[model samples]
Target: MISKNTIDQVFETARVEEVLGDFVQLKKSGSNYKGLSPFTDERSPSFMVSPVKQIWKDFSSGKGGNVVAFLMEHEHFTYPEAIKYLAKKYNIEIEETEQSSEQKQQEDERESMYLVSEFASKYFQNTLLKTEQGKAIGLSYFRERGFTDETIKKFQLGYCLDEWDAFTSEALRKGYKLEFLEKTGLSIVKGEKQFDRFKGRVMFPIHSMSGRVLGFGGRILTNDKKAAKYLNSPESEIYHKSKVLYGIFYAKQAIAKEDNCYLVEGYTDVIQMHQSGIENVVSSSGTALTSEQIRLISRLTKNITVLFDGDAAGMRASIRGIDLILEQGMNVKVCVFPDGEDPDSFARKNSQADLQEYLLENAKDFIEFKASLLFEDAKNDPVKRANLIQDMVSSISKIPNQIQQEVYIQECSRIMDISENVLFSTLSQILAREGKTSGVQPKKAPAMEVVRSPEAVKTKVDELFELERKIISLLMLYGTAEEEFEDMVLKENDKGELVMEPEIQKAKVFEKIFLDLQEDEVAFTNERFRELYSRIISLLNEEGEVNIEKFINGLDPELSSEVTTLLMEEEQYRLHEWERMNIMVKTKETTIARLVGETILALRRFLISQKIDDLSRKIKESSEEDTKESMEDIMDYLSLKKVLSNKLNRVM
Candidate 1:
């Protein structure tokens, strides 16, 4: 267990902006920063980060919290894992209490797999440096590729011996489980025999965005034509190639700093680009680009430049990814290297500046690039050219922003030598097709047909609204108070006058609400509202101040999001900003304690009045001997009404 003091230190030292900026691109807006919501698929910027409050709120999804909360929400990290990540990032020393074997055994299986993968990475890397076979084969292969020793070490390059079961034996001797080895795809098992999966190949460890080793990618060296060029770890608990981008661990900072990412297609391409001084480069690892991977890059930067080989097939295959990027509201540009050249070969042939200039001059927006590349064959054919125009409009319609989509349509029409109205009509058809395909519609609830006195229902709703308003006011004002109300007695002096001693007291509305709900046995109908009310009361008791900021900061992301949505919603009666600035807003001169007491009394009176009205209407409508029962109910209602009326009169 981490000490409470250490947790406090971690929270205090970690800055919200600095931590979140690593993942989400933020731009200054007023006293806060705004970016596209990472929690949802949205085009416009709705996620907000406040430096003054040290918190973030996703206006779209409603997730808000401190830095640790952001990590937990965005990265799916647990509390302890988030803390450790922050501790590592901030270079803080962590002191932990020793855990018993049983407690250690209770750790999550995924986390355990991650730990085992990390251990295997270190073992393979150590073998490369310490063992003769690893040094001769792995080190030699890397050196032959012109990889400096520093680069080799930086990427943790390693090798596995050709001898069967060498890595398996070493891991077992070190007490690592063979089951986990197979689970992480590090060891292949046939019947009862287990052997290292990457034996006789050079190692390339694949990492999660946070730099944890999730799996590995190995390249074979022998000239056997039957042997595959590269083999990556199969899907495991921690590694999903579709959702993971290679080199994100190394490229994140550079991506953030440059505000752009250069995406290529191989591990060596990534290594060579970084080696040649372009640090913000990542690879797709030869898989089809996925929206998840695009989102991963989108979180760090809004601009992406895809570098592909000049082969026609390769360019065609990669054009599909551009539509995905456009759908994300990312600004995408494409640069095709010369024939027979990839990013690795191109970077190696030129200096960083020359290569950067070459890319900058050659890169074109998706629309222009797509048209120029595809229009050559369709120039003389009207039907094929019309089909090409439709295809471009379909891609344009995927862009969420109306303005961006319109701009692309105009560009498409101009480039294709077609009428703008023709492209616009195509876009409308595409949208209609998408709407039908998605079946997007607002859900309607079946109406309840309860017969009741309209006045009674209205009165009940009004009373409930008043009670809620009072509770909201009190919570906003004195939720942090620590004491109960003080009592006072009044005595008649002479004639019909009464004199009372004034008592200034602190009120505990939170406690009162809890106890009152328990006493009246009234159940809240809305589960979220009930949970939020209960949590607010608990938080008030835990901290002297309810600190709206801190309370929201510590809540679970889903709940926090709901609470933020509630608090930030505009009420029907709101003071205008100008009125507030001019101090024209009404002020209750009476103490907040008294206001709370009066508010509760008013709610009780209101509810009693509603009951009286209901009974009166029933008496007017009913015609039975049960009229006697109705009469009794009316009497009871009047009696309570009289008592409430007296209380209300006395308070006024």
Candidate 2:
């Protein structure tokens, strides 16, 4: 086990937004950072990381915590592993006795593999930037491709030497396990011998969204006829070729910001476009684009523009990705470069403005682009033209949205010079055929339960439960905030009669809540709330304020999860930012004092009502002797009720 001192230091030093930004593309939102949830498929951003609070909340998936929790949940790090990862990241020295075995690959195979891949990426990069062989080969290749020194460093581009075992031997000397070396496919192991997988090639490290190196795509600098020009890391535990995009780690923010994604076919294409200031772009990693790959972009934007080579073979090879994009209901546009040109060449030859203009001008809807490509030689031939029309409709039919399908059908009709009805009939035929083969009918939505007011259906226990929840939320959110509270005091006036009056007093939120609840002798009804209530109170009293981060870190997973959930409930409403639209919306932060007082007033009123009801029932069940005492109790309770209503009026 790691020392508590180390864990505490990690938590205090690790910035939530900074740490999460590596894995999730985060943009500033007022005081917090917001991004799309990496856990689920979504178009809008629902994940929030608060740097001040030092916690994260993914409202979409409802999984959140401090920095370590994010690593544990996303990276699948064990508790000790998470701490060590942080320690390494922050350059904190872990006590040797606790972390002696941490370097072994056998302890956690997946994480060890990740560490090795990361180390390999750095090794290759060092060789490229520092070594004579790598500088002559890899640096020359990137520079010739119009990549600047800054661009090279930003992408962490590197090169591995041609000599076999160079990378493997260095990794072994550094104490990286050979098992992870082979598992990540960075090295080719044969019994007692090991060789570098990417030797003699310019390296393009394929990164996970969080910026961990999953694998590499190395381009051969020499024209060796016996070797594949482009070699990719073999499918490994961390790197799945079909699921990774070359520049996604860098392009994610721009994609979300521009609300458009430009999909390319290779690493150089992505790097060149990004160098040309086209930041909202990524590569399919030189493979046929998959739905999984498309879904990754869909999380950022529902609009994709695929840049294909101008050659007929290149166009034909990439034609199917459009259908897959359409199937995901994304608005896809195809931009084929001029003859003898691709994104890499065009980006190199033209200025940024010219490239941007060319892309904007050439981009066509899927139907128009498909028609132009498929009808290249078939336009004058009636039989082939009709077949090509069928192909066009087939792609359109893949669109899941009926409205988008109809729009594309209209375009197909216009471009193919066919009747709209004819295209619609053909699309219907394709969809109907697919539906029949699909064989899964959509299930109807389950009936929604009718909601009634609490007055009509709630028991006293339920009401108390809700009130208790509010108390917890208030304490958790604003316990240390100082505010002026109106304490309603019942006292004897000059007329010697007991009368209720308001006493204005300033108090910390926790003190106000603590005194009121203690005054009323109110106990929490729910077990979790009861525990949290006492714990929060104790922390406030003992520490003079709640250390939310420390308190949450000390909690068990269940309670910590509960605290995160409660804290993030308001984030859903905050995302709307209705005040920007002049809606005059009030935030809880502005009215916390009133909020605390009202919650307590409501709790007091409910308890008083319950007491009056209990007394009335007893009066009915008992004799005249009991009725006298019950009537006086009811009168006093009514007076108390009147005082509560007045207090509520002031608080409201």
Candidate 3:
């Protein structure tokens, strides 16, 4: 567990703009920053970050909060993981508080293993850069492959010595536990003997999305027939190859910004392309792709452009990954290099612009690419051609969106020279056998329509919901503003008649709202509104140290979504660049005090009118004595309503 003091220090030191700028490309927009939504793909920028408030809101995805929340959302990090990441970035020493022995041990072991892996990564790099053997063999091997020194370091490329105990001895001497070193697979422990796992090999450290060293992939310099040409860290507690993608930590931002990922086969392919200024690329490390890896890319972008080597057999063998990607509802394209070249060699042989041009020119939708490539092999054979059609339909069936499936089926019909009816029949058989709904889903009323249907009825519950939402929005936007307010109170004067008296008081907006609601003894009808109101009042009372990120991050998902929606609701209209039209807009910031008072008054009038209606109903339903009593109560409530209405009218 992290202490509150550490969290406070991190919040105060970690700048939202600086931390987020590393991932999202932000440009100044008025008093804030705007960028394309990192959480979703969109041409226009709907993501806004407020430097003053140290908060971010993605209007497109409605995921917003302080910097830590961004890390948690973007990197899928746990709470402690996010804190430690920021602490490391800001160079803050993290001081952990005490926990139970079992709990602490569980966390300590995982962290210790991570530390051991990180240390081993650095040791290998130092050997590659600083030692004679690593430099002569490892660094030379990389540079010979056209990897620049900068690119090498950026990827944290390293080399392990040939000596059996070189890495093992160093890690043990540095006080890394033997258990952790063995568990991380950096050391092979057999009986009393231990040896470095990647002896005499250049290392490629694979990192998690948060940039922590999860594992390593090593390639041998000399082709030893007895040993594997390449070695990867065995599956461990922290590293699972299926869920990890090489260069993802480096390529995540570029992938999101470009809205496309270039998938390749090997580490060199990724590094060469990155060196050639194509940064939105990652590799499966020569392993067959997995659904987990595709979903990992799906988090940053919905479009994937796979770069295949020129080997025809290998390209066809890798088509299984396309189905996994399609199952996630992501768009995929294929880019096969020239017959003699892979991504690495091709990138090295061309300029950045040329490489970019080649990718842009050759990349094709998966359907077209598959059809053309398969059609060649199926030439002059009807059976093979039928198999090709089923292949296309099978891949299309993996797509969850029915509309996307229909479009792909139509395209397949044209490309395969088959009728649309046959394609639909094949699609139906595939879906029915798989227990999925038939592909033809009839269109209903759009969930979002331009206008409401005329037959739809309106009710007071809708008005109450809006009024409750308005009060919460006011608290969210301007809870800390301090200003004077006029409070109207009904009192009996010397003439024995009811009269309205106005009293002036100075208080914070939150204080005024809290006191007004308390005086009215109001109970919010909406569940979320009631909870959020209590939370805001609590924060406002905390000596104005209102941390919006902490406030939002502390909430559950549903509540967090509600808060982000409310926070960004007002900014939605302002984002249209309305000021460019030469129309001077009056902002609510200038009149928060009045707005707060009017909102309270309007709510009071609604509540009073509701009460009067209840009493009016009783007048008709009760006995004569009860009717007279209800009539008197209604008259009194009507006079109070008059007073409330007059005050609200003046504000209006």
Which candidate wins on TM-score? Answer: 3
- Which lDDT tens digits does candidate 1 get at residues 1-652? 8766667678778888889998899987656677777766677777777686667777766567678888876765668889999888888888767778776665456767898889888988988889998888888888887788898889988888887889888988989888888988999999989988888889899988777999889899998788788999999878899999889888876786577999999998999899999988999898999999999998788999999887988799778999998888889999999999989889888899998899889999888888888899788999888878877888887788777777787788779888777777777778887782322222247588988887666533655654664565566455665555533334455774444444655546677655656765655555555666677776677865566666665667766665554443331113123354665544443465566666665666666666767777887788876677888877765655555456457531
Q: Each model's C-alpha lDDT?
A: 0.76, 0.84, 0.88
As for TM-score, the candidate ahead, 1 or 3, is 3
TM-score of 3: 0.77
> Which whole-number lDDT from 0 to 100 does residue 652 have in model 3?
18
* Preferred candidate (lDDT higher): 1 or 2: 2
Candidate 2, 440: how far from true, in Å? 17
What are the TM-scores, per candidate, against the unseen true structure? 0.60, 0.64, 0.77
Q: Tell me the TM-score of model 2.
A: 0.64
Best by lDDT: 3
lDDT of 3 by residue, 295-398 (tens): 89988889999998888998889999989889988999999998989999999999999999999999999999898789988968999989989999999999
Checking candidate 3 for backbone clashes, the offending pairs are none
Model 2 clash pairs are 23-210
